[model samples]
Target: MAEVVGPRLYSCCHCRNHVALHDDVISKAFQGRHGRAFLFSHALNIMVGPKEDRQLMTGLHTVADVDCSDCRGVLGWKYERANEETQKYKEGKFILENLNIVKENW
Candidate 1:
């Protein structure tokens, strides 16, 4: 069994860019754009670009792909806009499960 450490630190596997703390991880598995899977987090240090409009199960959402700041690898995406209700929580949120996370002893 895995032990529960304080706060797990995460970094981009490619460029070793600091991503977020495990405490911010909201979902371990999430289905994203084009049926892609991802790890959801409340906060992430990523670059979002090429905004696009997408229809989600909850509602219409304007999102953009988020990439690693250093390596420019496709990490996940950002929710730029959403319905009035969804926007309150979805906006500015990010996902980075597709990208590799560096596991190290801190």
Candidate 2:
């Protein structure tokens, strides 16, 4: 479980719609998406759009762009699965950023 720091919430930047709870945050330093760093967590509350096939060194992978359920702003990508069994660990993983965090009243 992530450190519960009191009333902190996560939401979409554009629409401010609730995305996930603060404790759901897995890592804020996950490196992904065009070699840039982002947040990593389990299946988020965001809506997953159409999936696009991507070719990887390991094998073919499928990823869907996740967006805010309300405003439809692009937040991050969801790693659906890869053709290789060794890459199964990335299945159903989300990569977002700290910007998506909605700070609550302290």
TM-score top scorer: 1
For candidate 1, give the lDDT of residue 12.
83
Stretches of model 2 off by over 4 angstroms after superposition: 1-6, 32-45, 55-60, 84-86, 99-102
What's the lDDT for all of these models? Answer: 0.69, 0.67
TM-scores for candidates 1 onward, in order = 0.68, 0.66
Worst 10 residues of 2 by lDDT: 31-40
lDDT of 2 by residue, 1-106 (tens): 5565656666676777766655656666565444433445553557898889977545787988888877777777788887788978777877765555454433
Candidate 2 displacement at residue 36 in angstroms: 5.1
| lDDT score for residue 39 of model 1 | 48
Task: State model 2's lDDT.
Answer: 0.67
lDDT of 1 by residue, 15-102 (tens): 8787777676666656655443444555466777999988766778888987877888776678888876845576777766543666
Shift of residue 53 alpha carbon in model 1, Å: 0.5
